[model samples]
Target chain A: MAKNQSEVSGIFTAGSKSKPSAAKPKNPFTHPLLLGSIFPLLLVVVWEVLSRLEVFPAYQLPAPSVILGTIAGMAEDGTLWGHVFITSYRVLMGFLLGTAAAVVLGSLVGFYKHAEALFDPLIQAFRSIPSLAWVPLFILWMGIGEPSKIAMIAVGVFFPVYLNIVSGIGGVDRKLIEVGKMYGLNMFQLVRRIILPASLPSFLVGLRSGLGLGWMFVVAAELMGASQGLGYLLVVGQNTLAPETIIASIVLFAVIGKLSDWILKKLETRTLHWQDRAAKS
Target chain B: MSLQLERVGRTFAGKPAVQDVSFRAEPGEIIGLLGTSGCGKSTLLRAISGLDNAYDGVIEINGKKVNGIQKTTGFMFQEPRLLPWLNVLDNVTFGLEGNREEKQKKAGRYLESVGLAGNEILYPKQLSGGMAQRVAIARALATSPEILLLDEPFSALDAFTKMQLQDLLLEVWRSYRSTMVLVTHDVDEAAYLCDRIIVLRGQPGTVEREIAITESRPRERGSSELAAYKAEILASLDLTTETA
Candidate 1:
């Protein structure tokens, strides 16, 4: 009765114990996380050396040091936080809105044939439209305001989440559903207990991809017209011919994008720990 | 509760799978539907469980006709079919209806009865095939249904594990006494566990013979009595070659 049920010590370790002799203590050097960064570190070192040697013009392509300096200068002036904050805020709002819409529409279409026939073709048609082509129309409709910017990002986020939800629900094992039916669960209980949890892995995959698209659309949104945001800095760097400023913004984008994705990946790992996966080699 | 299946028949896309399958399971009786592959043993079990209501005749439990899945019946599929997301304890409690604490308490007892005590924290993915099937059996019995239907529950297991589970099932049945209808192709399994063996044969299977097992509880696995029954069931199935 007093057991700690939440302890998940061996949760993610299954079906990979085929070779007992292969179960040596892991080598730190062979660790995937450590090994993955080496190539990127090498590239940075090469870029730093080449720029210092004046192999590239500073005006056209600045050194990594210069871009770091620009970023540090912005941080000192307090503008860095504001740009990062506003851009992230836009993406967050758009992500929430798009995810909500996708869940509603996707569940309906996935569960019912009539809903699929009624809405799927139209949604598919809209998906085929180039995301960038919506920029001018969105700007004209909402007048280059925060609404238009958020709306643009929402459009980008919607398709992936929607499509993934549909497929996820469709891909649910019929045998699992039969189990629910055998238990005499009603339709609502069946959906809540079986369908929702079964499709959750794909849903989370959709969320991560949707978030990535949200970041891409935020760049497009701010590029069209914006007073504050990292995307706006890209335009200012271009107009003022400051390559370091442009590169600094790009670096910030990469850092923040990777950071957000890392959070989502952590969440995915925690929730899907029950999945029977191959050992990480 | 006694179960009665009267002239039960099922067809898939105009092709008959089982026809005129009539049988009755007395209260606390273990009835085995024994057959070779494609003999519609599972089809008949499904119809009796009310999972397939499109069958040609009436299936009644306690004299009331079955409409759909019966609240008084529990079913075990060939595969464990444990929802991978739930741990052992939760999977055992999945079909139970009650307060959380009560459900867990009942689930704990059933898990222990199936010899899976102390492993409640483990998930289905971590369980070996036999262990997973033990959890499935625990889950099915947790509801304490008056009737339990099993579709080749031990068919996927290793020979040693299969024998151990067969004994475990009989042990559980001694206490719970749920009228069990087991569909199995294993001649030894049917002979070892059943009170009556209904041998089904051929496509669109129907009951070809019913062999009564009057040897009583705690019958030895490889006893001459059970071996004779196995031979009889095998002979009934081998007749399929000529009938087909």
Candidate 2:
């Protein structure tokens, strides 16, 4: 028995030694941030070279420097900040409204069987219609103002959050619910303590996707509207044959989209820290 | 607290899972519901815990009929079932009703008793399997329940870890003296820890036999006296041809 015990302890020590060696230190040059920039930088270099050679007419494919110059010009007049602020405010209001409605409705449907029976089919059918298809109808009813634009963005954000919230609540582990019951938690306590926390990771996934779609819908709404937003800027640029303005607007959209996504990603890391550790180990 | 079950029965879609089961447990007694797989021992444990309300007949805890989950019982499942988002201290204090300071103190005491004194801040995912289960044990004990219903709690553990936990369980039971009903398929485990073993068998499962341990702990492990009890249980389970 002593010999057997010693052999078992030896095996355990050997196992621990092997695990550390398996996780070799990553190379510094191959870091993710550095690797991610390579392709975009290469593309910019190629675009600069092509524009210098006058490959395409400057009116159609303006050089990167010309787009930068347009940005600088807009900044001087303070129009760039105005357009950015208005567009951001619209997106923010729409996203918040959509998220609030989705969470409330989703919780009702997810928790109660009768609510699911009443609302599921209608919502699922309505969600199938493309969000952009609502733009014309919204403009017709609410007019070519901020309301229509915000409504369009809200519609864009709603479906993904609703679908994800419903599925997340539905997919909570039954065993965890049983554990709650075993501990003598009341219905309210069960929802607050167990179901909500369990569904959060999935809900965050939906929020990230909804944020992405919000940007897309904002651009589409602006494409058909009056004035004073990035989408209107794009249309005005096209009418005046100013490709630099169009490129500048597109770049701004990209930067804002990347920034909002980065914020959400940080929140996910903080809230789902447990999931990250579980995955690693 | 004492527990009494009178003609308890559970069914699923008109098929009986457990039928006409009746037993009585005196206060602070450690009883093992021993059986093979598919013998409805776990189903019986669930009924006793009041997690399943669609059952026939009466389950009484301390002379009160249990209709829903009772406040006097704590249940430990096969898996540790710790809420993954909570740290060890928070998980141990879960479902406990008290002022924040009182709850934290109680949780701290239980964690210390489970030999997890310095690991209160670790999340569930960061702990090894045995350590996680120990934290779960602390959580169950923190409630100071009159009865602890454990359904195959150690079955998922490795042999060495299982033995260590068994010792820990015995120690905890000695200190708390809570009524315990453990469901397990392992004969040696039942023989070693239980004051009495209730053997369950067949479909629409019913009690087959009952044996009293009679020996006192700390009983010697692998001794001939304990071996005799194990042999009797094995024969009852039909794993051997030897006559008891």
Q: Would you estimate the TM-scores of all the predictions? A: 0.94, 0.94
User: Model 2: runs farther than 4 Å from truth?
Assistant: A1-27, A276-281, B240-244
Indicate which candidate wins on lDDT. 1
* lDDT tens digits by residue: candidate 2, A144-244: 99899889998889889999999999999999999899888889999999999999998999999999999999999989875788888899999999999
Model 1 superposed RMSD (Cα): 4.6
Worst lDDT 10-window in candidate 1 chain B: B235-244
Q: Which stretches of candidate 1 lie over 4 Å from their true place?
A: A1-26, A31-33
Interface RMSD of 2: 6.7
For each candidate, the alpha-carbon lDDT, in order, equals 0.90, 0.88
Q: How many residue pairs collide in each prediction?
A: 0, 0
lDDT tens digits by residue: candidate 2, B128-165:
67777888899998998899999898887778878888
Per-residue lDDT tens digits of candidate 1, residues B1-244?
A: 9999999889999999989988899999999998878878888888887788888999899898877888889999999999999999999999999999999999999988887777887777677777788899999999998999999999887777787789998888989899999998888888889999999987878889899999877889879988887888788777657667
DockQ of each: 0.47, 0.42
lDDT of 1: 0.90
Name the lDDT of candidate 2: 0.88
